[model samples]
Structures are given as C-alpha cells and as structure tokens.
Target: MDRVIIAGGGWSGCAAAVQAKKEGADVTLLERTDMLLGTGLVGGIMRNNGRFTAAEEMIAMGGGELFQVIEENLKHKHISFPGHEHGDLYDIGKISGAVFRFLKEMGIHIYTKSRVLHAQMKDRRMINVTDAEGNCYSGDGFVDATGTAGPMNNCSKYGNGCAMCILRCPSFGGRVSLTSLAGVQEKMGRRPGGAVGSMSGSCKLYKESLSLEIQERLGRDGVAVVPVPPELVEDHLEKKSCQQYALPEFRENLVLLDTGHGKLMTPYFPLEKLQKIPGFENARYEDPYAGGKGNSMRYFAMAPRDNTLNVEGVDNLYCAGEKSGLLVGHTEAIVTGVLAGHNCVRRIQGKQQIILPDTLAIGDIISYVKQEMDTPEGMERKYTFSGSFYFQRMKEKGLYTTDTALIQKRVEEAGFSRYFSHSGKKDCVS
Candidate 1:
C-alpha cells in the first residue's frame, strides 16, 4: 500500500486521512498541537444556508463520515440565527476527541504535537517531513493541509497581538507550512482593504458567565440574540474573515450560539462593553483569552494549487483547507481535503487524478476558488458555501438547494456517488 502523509490535522487534514484510508492507502496525519481540529476546537456551526447543500452533496459523494459524526454530537439542529438558517451546532467540547477516535478507527495514524518544520524532496516530488521534535515521517504522496492561520507573528503583525485563538501558536511553535518546506512559492490572502490577513470572525464566551436568561435561552434554543446598544456597537466588520456574517444585524446585536459555549458572532467585543449589556454582566471570552482585543489571524500562507488541489511546482504534493486558498469554513476544508486525499492516491497509482466537474457544488467551488484567487479583489475576500461571495454565486447559478434527495441524485448523475467509499480491511472498530 502507498503511504500517504497529511500535514496539519485540522478538519481538512483529518478528512484527507479518511479519504486516503478509504482508498486503501496507508495514512498518517500530523497535527501541530496536542489535539486535532484546529479552529474547529471552537467552531461548531454547520449546515448553515448553502452549507446545507454543500454538506448534503458531500454526503451523497460518500465523503460525509465526519459530517455524520459532527451531527451525532450536535447540541442543537435545524436552527436559525442572524444571516444563517437551518444550522447545526455541535458540542465543540467533544468534537475533536470524536474526530480523533473516528480517524483512529479508520486506521489512519495520527501524530499530535508533530509540527512539520521541514521537508525532504527529490526534484519536485516530496519524500518526507521532519516535525518540531526532530521526528521524521516518510510518505509516497503528501497533502499540505497546513492551514494558513498563524505562527503568532502574523497575528501580531496583521491583527491585534494574539488573542490566543484555538491554534495555540505560542506553545505549538506556530504553523510551519509543508508547501513552503517543499520549496513551493505560496500565496498570502488579504483583508477587506487589502490588508495582509483577516481576523477570526467570531469568539467564544464561557456559557456560565452569561446571564441566566441568555444562558437558558441558548441552552434551550441553541441561540440568543441580544440587541446591542448603538453606543456599544463596534464596526470591525471589514476586518472579519467571515464576510458572510458581516451584516448590520451582527453589528447591532450580540448574536450568541450554543456551541458548548456562547459563540460570540463577532471578531472581538470590548470586555468592558460586553459586561454592560444586559444578560452579559459577567461576559467573558473562552477560546481567545483576550477577545476584547482581537482574535487569531488567518489566510497567511495559502499554497498555489490547481482545482484538483495538486500543489503547483511539486509533483506528489497536494493541498487543502486554507492552504489551498482563501476558502474558509470547515465544510469547504473537509470537501477539499476529501478531493485531495482521493487524488493523491491516484497520483501514486500513476492514474489520471480526478476532478469534480463544475456540475456539482463541490466541483464548482474547488474550481471557482482557484480561479478567484488569481485576482486582487478575490484575494481580499473569503469564500464559503455558507455565505459571502460564493454563496451568492451558488444561488445565482441555481446550485443552492436544501433538498437532500436532489443533492444525492445530482451526485449520482455526476458519476461520483459514494466516490470515496471503498471496502477495505478493518484494523479495529473499537
């Protein structure tokens, strides 16, 4: 069996490992931190707006294992909040562990605290990677899921000093790109006004710190929208990576979702000001311990790659997630990871790598992001199936639908239903 190594065990890397294992490849996933699911440690929103369609499409294509696991861990489902609808909020506290166990069961070797700091390559093909602790891993083909988030310096230089978001760069020694190690010229995306990077769109507030009514409402309905006084409203929308949520509603209100915490739908709110709001007198941040200032910065080290996710200038290297472009959201990352994983195996087999046709949302997005990333304006923006430029485009193209049957049928017609599913030897089911 061909050994497929995946760097950065975020949602993308985990998904890549799953697809690779499903294709009967020996898989190894490396995560910089002690845990898996990078930003997903605090990010729990799923299937919001067009994300529902994209997710269903993924399920139809037989790449929905992680999505299924997430749904199983959801605290609330079929919810509506702000600009998002029919959303599901998972138990962020349990998701990483759940994903870890699933990947382990799938027979993918996962290494935490294994940050890839260097790569050995022959010509354009990568041979292996060395981690921060001097541990080396070899592979037949590699997937650069090392997301374009932070190494702390980017956060300090671009946004506010590390609000200490989930990436935990301070301890993990920051994200070192596998593509960069492989000597590929990577790209950097911009904020709205052509700034270097974008701030994380939201933060997490400890659920216990919120007022009883807000906590009760959130725990019950999975969301609580409290109107923010105009005087306290902050206008940092332009700095947000999640442009989809950069709306007047978000600015005018404190939108909190129950993601095993109060998911504050803003980049950062002044802690003093947040305390002044009703039902938030004890408000406090959870993930970015310094949410009053700013959150972690992202889109810093995007690798230049084709729609099929093959890293340009490298023969056996592929990329997904933020490393692939300015594509944001876990759904986008997982889908791209799935494609990259499947295709890398094909590359090792000396077969033509497959590309999802534009007929499907997954295919269109993979192709669309690469095309859009070529332009200046596109670089200054983010893309996701849930919202922003891409969702609108999905609507305009008549590709947005909540009907799961239609999505499944579409995948079948595209000749890719259960495309990633393969019966392979089982190592352990426990």
Candidate 2:
C-alpha cells in the first residue's frame, strides 16, 4: 500500500485524508493541536458552496452522502431579517468533529499534539518531516495542510507574511453577514430601509490592501456596507499572523461577527469600537474564545503548471490546503484537501489525480492568488504609501465588490457578460 502523510487536521486536511483513504491509500494525519476546529470559523462564516443545492451536494459527495452528512455535521438555521435572511450560526467544533470521525473510520492514522518543525528534502522533493520533539516521520507522499503553518512558512519559494482579525458587534446582540448588498434595491423593487452595512453577507478581508480603500470609496458611492478603518494599522502592518476556527456562540438573534484580524479570521462586528460609533453603544463580545492566537498560515496558493502538489526547491515534500496555494473557504478547503490527498496517493501510485476548473468561483479564487494576482511588478506598483493605494487599485481593478451587478459589470468589462447573468435573488431559506 502507498503511504501518505497529512499535516493539520482542519477542514482541508480532514477532507484530503478521507479522500485519500477512499482511494485506497494508507494515510497518516499530523496535527499540532489535538482537535480539528478552525479559529476563522468561530461563529462560522457563511457556508458558501454556491447555492443551497451546491452546499447540499458538498455535504453529500464529500465522503458521506447528504442526510448522513447532516446527521454527522452541525445543521444551522438562518434568521429572518426585515428584507433578508442570515445563515444559521453553525457549531464549528461539532461539524469538524463529525468530519474527523469519518476520516478515522476510513482507516487514516491521526497524530495529535505533534508539530512539524521542518521538512527534510532532497532534489526539490520533500522526503520527511521532523517534529518539535525531534522525532522524524517519513512517507511516500505528503500533504501539507498545516493551516498556514506548513505551507506558507515551510514551503513557499518566496517567504510571506499576512494577518487577519475578528470584529464583534458593538452591542450585546447584533447581526452580521458577508452577503453582498450591491444592487440589492433593484432585486426587491425597493431598497432595504435604513443604512446597509457589511453585506457579501460574507466578505473576505485582505491584509490592509487597496481593497480596504475601495471599500471606503464604495461607501462614498452610496453602497451600504463599508470597511471600518483599521483600529491599529501600524501594529498590524508590522507583524502578521493567520488562523482558522470554529464559530463563536451568540445571543438570541445576535450574529457573531469577525473580520481579518486578531485570533480568528471570521466575521467581525467591532464591539469596542461600536461604543465609540454614534449609533452603537451597547455592543459586546458574543462568545469569547480562549486558545493560542489561532490556526493561521501564510502559504502558497497552488501547484506548478502541471498542477502537481510538489513545492519547488522544497524536497521530500508536498503542500495541501492553504499551504499549497489553495485560497478557498471551508468548502474549498475540504474539497481541495480531498484532491491533494488523492494526488498524494496517485503520486505514490505513479498516476494522476483529477483537478477542478477555474470557471468555478472556488477554483478561480485559488488559481488567481496562487498563479496570477499580486505579481511582483504589480506589488511594486501598488505597495506604496499614497494613503489611497489600496482603495484606488480596488476600484480600478474592481476587486472588492462581490455584488452580483458589480460582478456582472466586471465580467462584462472582461467581455464575459454575454455569457453570464446576475440573478438578484439570494438563496431562499427552506
């Protein structure tokens, strides 16, 4: 039997190991911590796999079929807003535990409280990993799913650093979502009354890039959601961290919030600052999580042109999930892990595994960040202290708006609008 090793048992690692086992390969999973919960997911980010059915399909085909999947996973119920609905507050621990349980049943070996200190390599391939205790583990193929730890730090050809934080509601109970609020008025025939804030319902916060500035400009353009200026930009810019997590708990009707900051990188509501804001004075942290800063990584986005999992110049090695240049959310992490694990097995078997297409949102996100976006030249041009560098780039490149109409405009600008249409309707609550 071929041997495959995976680091980190988070969503991507779990998925990869399960998939590899299903492919009939022997597997070992190493986790620095004892559990599979991700900090970024505390108060779980909106689970996006396209529409409801796509989400259902992910639950179904991702190792276990849908109903069984639901029974094993955490099922969340969204709340009814005045004109919209917010996704349910999923229990991150419960869901990850279920996934871990399935992986275990599939005959995968799991090592807890073990940290990969370094990867032993030869001729551009990783051969083994040395744990913190000085124990060495070797395998025929390896999966680097160590959140941002294994891949970004250990394998990237170019070293990297990034940071994320979580913002909470200023009041005791408040709601937040990454749901896109762009062009929401046209769909409902009337705009939602009052101010619109932080829709996408799920928004991805970058590392103090021009995207932040674009969000500010978009606010000036009368868009509802706006990016709050960083409370401590200099501090955040000086150092970097990455992490993932289970969702934070919330009070009745109050949605737990996060942003790309602090411990976990989830939706933020800005509780402390809410007290300073004129409209909010009663904000508070919903469920405060206590743990190491969080599971974070600054790693590559994808593999080489052939799409093999190997990281060049890094020997006896492979990277999976965030470490391998895969930038998807929870769903993509799991799915990519499956693929990475499968690839590891196949590499050992001297065969090829399947790959997803870039046309898919998840696929494209990974592809661009890993292979294209933020080129060295582009970085040199934009990484300046113009005070509005990030904002200007976001507008010019149209990067920050996920609004369907705005997305449509961008697609049209790229000459793909004729092939796609923006359906203003959001996913209906069942």
Index of the highest-lDDT prediction? 1
Best-matching candidate per TM-score? 1
Candidate 2 lDDT, tens digit per residue, 162-196? 11222121221111100001100110000013211
Q: What lDDT is obtained when candidate 1 is compared to the true structure? A: 0.89
Residue lDDT tens for model 1, 1-430 = 8999999898899999999998889999999899999988889989999989989999887889999999889999999998898999999999999999999998889889888888999988999999978998989999999888887988999889988888887888888888899887888888766789899989999999998899899989999999999899898889998999999999999899999999999999999998999889998899799999999898888998887799999989999988888888999899999989988988898777788888888889889988988999888889999998999999999899998999988888888777777654321211
Model 1 / residue 284 / CA error / Å: 1.3
TM per candidate comes to 0.97, 0.54
Model 2 Cα shift for residue 256 (angstroms): 3.4
Q: Candidate 2 has what TM-score?
A: 0.54
Backbone clash total for model 1 is: 0
Q: Give the TM-score of candidate 1.
A: 0.97
